[model samples]
Target: MKHSNGAQLFLRNDPAKTAPLSTKKPLTIGKASTNLLCMPQTDGVADHHAVVRWSVGHGWLICDWGSQEGTFLEGQRIRNCRPISDGDEIQLGKVGPVLVFRLAPASSQPTPEPAVKSSAGGNLEFAGQLIPMNQIKFVQLLSRPRYPASFSWWALLSLGALVVLPWPPAFWTLELVVLAGWIVLGSRKEHVLLVTLLDGMAYRHSFANKVTALGHRNGIRKAIGQPSSA
Candidate 1:
């Protein structure tokens, strides 16, 4: 470690091994690193895949990937997530080891805290309706997903596959089933859109008429000031 004026810098063979130093001046590391690894959002995650995946931020990435050996942090072997630290050795699953971490320049200022996002789950509320947690799954199954883009491609691919298939058992049932699924997926998108538009119009008209009627009733009731029903 060396100091110039009021700033200090640390040089290390491995940036991941450097520890955070407290300081009064803002410290800027040439490169910062952390052991916590986050993988890409995709690549599959199911109840049964064995290996789990998690995402951090920046360039940090971690994956059990399919390794049975697993990753570790502190002293605990993490089966659900990769290890992360201000500075530490990364024992990357079974594929040997890779040292990774954020390298912060030596500092005189108090070590700044990393930004963290809220991981808390929130509730969904509908006007005049309070849905209990247990009923959420039932409602979700009844609802449709947004922006499903596979239907059109499925339709195209199914058609192409049908053309290439020979006659009999293979093409006979499978082709029709594929076509049905493809069609169902398409119609679902259209159905959802139509329902949304119809509901929007109905809601608009219903609210407008309701407000107008309520206004008239209020006017009459105010004139009387005795008792009125709307």
Candidate 2:
């Protein structure tokens, strides 16, 4: 759905655009489609690997990874990511059994509860409220929050080594060229650290409440630790 402010959307699907989520969890994908994009994992279980990036900050989060048979969604085992929709059952690998996911659009409002004459199941012992799907626990595998302990500190050390030292003395242009390539790939972490460093600097220079300011910047309540704006 189009908004003047350009709320978060599934870059892939333009049909039913969404708004900021009720909660900042990854499952609360704003304006994104259920077409899951499973990125390639060299690891045996491609769809289940960490750093899966098909979610555009909003959408069904399938943690289908690592089992002899593999996880199945809606009776279909995903060889690669597939579009998910309401009533889709997600089978987590081994730990828990079958859990279904039901997606409800944001714009639809709850109708008023219908007046009841007599409870149909009044004599039957009631269990609890039926939560249709198991809660999806979201790990922002691709985008780690920029803070100390957010990423493997190994990332920082590698960048430091690359920046201060040149290639070995006996190394030829081939080695130098390879080193440059290494630096290029390793630079993603460096760029993130740079943002963290910038935040650090800002924290040092001012008296503004760090948590509140950062939370606002992240477009979430300060305590929730959500990563970005919608």
lDDT of each: 0.34, 0.34
**Model 1 stretches astray by more than 4 angstroms:** 1-10, 13-28, 31-83, 86-147, 176-230
Model 1, residue 7: C-alpha shift (Å): 16
| lDDT, candidate 2, at 216 | 29
**Model 1: how far is 152 from its true place, Å?**
0.9
Candidate 2, clashing residue pairs? Answer: 1-17, 18-31, 29-58
**Candidate 2 error regions (>4 Å):** 1-59, 72-83, 86-171, 190-217, 221-230
Best by lDDT: 1
lDDT of 2: 0.34
Tens-place lDDT digits, model 1, residues 92-162: 33433333344343563234322221222222222212222222221101124333765667767767767
Tens-digit per-residue lDDT, 1-230, candidate 2: 23323212232223343332221233311112331322232223333331121233234345433445465666666654555565555544433244334344555422322221123221110011111111111111122222434234445545555666566553344445555655555443311101122123211112124454343234211122334532
